[model samples]
Every structure is written in C-alpha cells, then in structure tokens.
Target: MFTLFYVLSLAIACSAVSVDVSDATNRIANGAVAANLQFPYAVSIQRIANNTQVSTRGHRCGGALVTLQHVLTAASCMFEWNADGTRTPITIGNYRVFAGAYLLSNDTATERVRNIAQYVVHPNYLGIPSYVGDLAVVTLSTAFASSTATPLSLPANNYNPADFTDCVVAGWGAATAASQTGANVEQKYANKYIYNQQECTSVYNALQGLPNILPTMVCAVSYDIVSSSCHGDEGNALVCGNTLTGILALHSNCAATSYPEIYTRVSNYTDWVRPIVSLANSFTSGASVLLLLTLIQMTFANLLS
Candidate 1:
C-alpha cells in the first residue's frame, strides 16, 4: 500500500495539465489570512490581434494595477505565437474596465465597458531554456473607478523575503488531478516559502534536472499533497503574509512531486519594473496635457459657434 501510494503521487505530479475539482476537494494548504484581508488589484486578460479573436475560457490571472493605467502580470501567461511565428496581441484591464469576473467562478461577470489602451510585455523576458522571470504591463483605456474593490495596492518598496516564509496563493486553478486545462474555478492554497535560490537549484535539479533558478525567481511548496494551485494559476499573485510579493510564473510541470512552484519576484525585478512604469506614467502625463489643450480649444470653438 505504501509503495502504491508513492507511485500514484509521482504520477499525479508528472501529469502535464490540471483540472478543477467539482465533486470532491482537498483541504487547501496555506489557506490562512488575517482577520481583515486587504485585496490586491485584479486584472483580466484576453488574446487577440488585428482582426481575429482567441478563446478566453481560462483567461484569468491575478494582477496589480500599479498606476491609474498600468496593470502588471507574468509575461509567461501572455507570450505566444501563431503558425507564422508572429507575436500575439493581449487585451488587459481592471474588472469594470473590461467585461469579466474578478474571482472568475462568480456568475454574472458579463459587463464589458472599457477597452485596453495599450499592452506591453517585458522585452527582457526569456521564455524557453529559462522558464522563469516573465513579467509585463498593460495600459488601460481609462482610470479605474475609485468605488470598486479592484483598487491597486502598492508593492512593498523593500519586501522582506522572510515575511513570505509561509504565504498564500489564491487563483482560479485546479485543486488537484493535474492538468490546468478546464473551465475557470477560483481557489486558494497556502504554501510555505521552502527555500531561496541555492535550495531551489538543488531541489529543481534533484526533482526535474533544471538549472539556473535565477535571482528573478523564488520557490514555494505546499506541505499538503492534495492541496495546490496548478497550470492556469500562472501569473497569479503570491501574497506574502499580507503584502503582495511576487507573481506566480510557473510550476514544475503542473504538480510535479517535491518540486515547488516558481514565481517572478516582483521585489527582485524592481529595477526592471521601474522603467516600464515610468514610460506608462510619462504617457499618462502627456495625454493629460493633450486633453487639457483639446478642451480649451473646444471651448473657444463653441464660443465662436
């Protein structure tokens, strides 16, 4: 019975995809939170191009709306190509800014109003051979509404890595039975920050034989075997204690055994994130000035008319 159980665990971990649990559910790991939980900004995304649209059935990832316009997410979730190898366009926005659900599993999420003004992926993101450290930003069509629960929270300027010694990961991902391909199902799991780069290198190699975990990433594991976030959970936020710390970039093949999920450390990439944010701010200021001038011109024209 012991040998059979071990083999079954490894097999489930090696499965390439994950499906959401509808009938039975496991006790979610790291599911604890403070009495009054503060919510981070959530952004919904879609893939499209000039004249074509892509499927959005499982098109949800947690994000932070840094400025009035910019929404940040893991680049791994957005990077894709067609048969011709052309870049695919991505659409991103706050809950009401676009038409989608926040928790995603919640019904009655069909309220599409605002459109995306621009979408920007980190140019430095390296995909294959190095599946870690993928991050990006999206500019929305307008400022988010202040009255909503989707307001952006500031990233901890100097995040204490120790704070995340044990953190929580929330997403609309499969509870178990690896293979993150299915209808959106929101779930949350608590995971302990197992170790840093040094340990991750050893753990990943021993488990999956991968190398160079990279300074831009961190590793996390759920002590509970049946409790975890899977594939579609990519790009979701890893809440360290109470502060939003990093973005869930990828896991070791869905739910590979003893292998922890890797995330793009937002704090580590602060240098890289600054420039992208600056560009968005500059664009916003320029547009604000342009709008002021246009309003003045329209007023003069109306006086003349």
Candidate 2:
C-alpha cells in the first residue's frame, strides 16, 4: 500500500542494498525507441537453424549479458512451442546471441555474434505449474568485447528490489499483446513501478485471476500506461541501474491490456547463478566440459506450460 517514492524515507533506516534512484526518470514508463547505446547490456537471443541465424525474423526472446561469457535468461526460452500445446526442447547448439544492436532489421557491425557453447537450466525448473525457478545461464562460444556489450552485475549481496525507485525493462516483445506478427523489430524500453511482496501477490490474484504468485518471484506494472511484457520477450532484462535484477517470467495477458508482469527475482537466486557462470573459466584451456546438470524430476507433474 506504500508508494515507491516512500522509499526515500525508508532508505534512511533500512539496511537494504541500493541502486540509482534517478533511473526511473531517464527510462520511460511506456514503450519508447531505445538509442543504439542506451542499453548495451541487452542482447537479442535468436534461434539458429542450418547453422545460420534467424535474424530477419525478430529475436526469439530478450536476454541480459550477465557476464562477458554468459547470459542470464528464462529457462522456458529453451523450448519450441508445438501445436499440441507441448514444448519441445531446442538444442543448445541451435541458440545464438546478438549483442549491441538497436534494430533487428539492420545488420550492424557492433553486433557480437556468439553461439551458445552450453546452457544450464535451473535444477528446480520442472515445468510443474511451470513458473518455479524459471532461470538459466548460457555460456557463449567466445567472450564478447567489454566495451561494446557490458555485463550487468548481480547484487553484491541479498538485495531488496523495493529499496530502489526506478526499474526499467527493455525488450523486443510485441507492441500490442494480441499481435503475433506485429512484434517489436526495434528494441523498446519502459519504466515499471515495483510492488511490495504483499501487493505483488494480491494484485496478481485480483487482476489476472491467477491462483498463485510464488515468493521466488517479484511483480511490477506500468500503472499509468498500457505497457506490459507481451509475446516474444519472456527472458528480457528488468534492470535498476547497472544491476540486472529480474528476468521476464510470465506475460500472461495477451489481450492488449496490462496485468502485473511477473519477473523472477535475481536477488533470490544470486547464490545459485554465480557458480554456474564462474564455472565458465574451465573453457579457458580450449577443452569442452561436459556439464552434468541435475535433471528436474517431472514424472508426476503436468508438462504443458
């Protein structure tokens, strides 16, 4: 029930980790054209086929460059939705990431094209109700240049997202919720108001008729505008300053109306993520490491997302 700006008064007492408070004004509340260098950490995650990137078609999902050699994104983006409402897991080798591009329509020299050498889905992402622990990290075939594609930092410690006032999400999701083909060719950025844990749960239940909003997640909404996460941008970055804090998890509304956009809180899983990315150092000797990830048990759960 507290306004996000009340954050100023609370900051004096709370031991919460802080980020840039002025970011909200600099980033728009609704969708707007992103300058070429505005968000250098954002990358277009595309599907590759026949060893060629499907770039002419818009990106498959948006992802954040969490490390010079790894990307932080939703685990669900690793699938291809079938007509029968089932998702087929795509091969990790078929994934390609293009960084430092403003528009997908134009081929820019700034693009750092790298194929995914490997990806590790979170051990808890079992496709049950489907949103639990929906996170993944992909190692790039080669590290990107530090100047062109900057990696956003994970919180130095257990960070409270509510401590910061401005949080922005930028992606190439659809302009309108219902338009499948009218997807964003140009990357767009928007400001979203973060809600407290209680309001996040209540607002989701009231607005989307959603039965559950887990503790592992955070919710935000563009209250003054119709902006919300839509089709094609499930793994976009939700950033507050240089910190990459959320990954777009569910954009359940597809009717040109806004609902509480769900994001997987990065702070909650920082411990699990850091090790996965740091392990990339093994690739230094030019030797392939077989990643033995713990398989999530899905035997008793519904597989449809």
- Native-to-model Cα distance after best TM-score fit, residue 87 in candidate 1, in Å: 6.3
In TM-score terms, which candidate is top?
A: 2
TM-scores, all models, native as reference: 0.67, 0.76
Q: Which lDDT tens digits does candidate 1 get at residues 60-114? A: 4445566656666777555443444344544343222332333443433434324
lDDT of each: 0.53, 0.65
| Ten-residue stretch with the least lDDT total in model 2 | 17-26
Candidate 2: segments with Cα more than 4 A from true spot: 1-30, 49-57, 107-111, 178-184, 205-211, 252-258, 284-305
Inter-residue clash pairs, candidate 2 = none
The count of backbone overlaps in candidate 2 is 0
Q: Residue 267 in model 2: shift from native, Å? A: 0.9
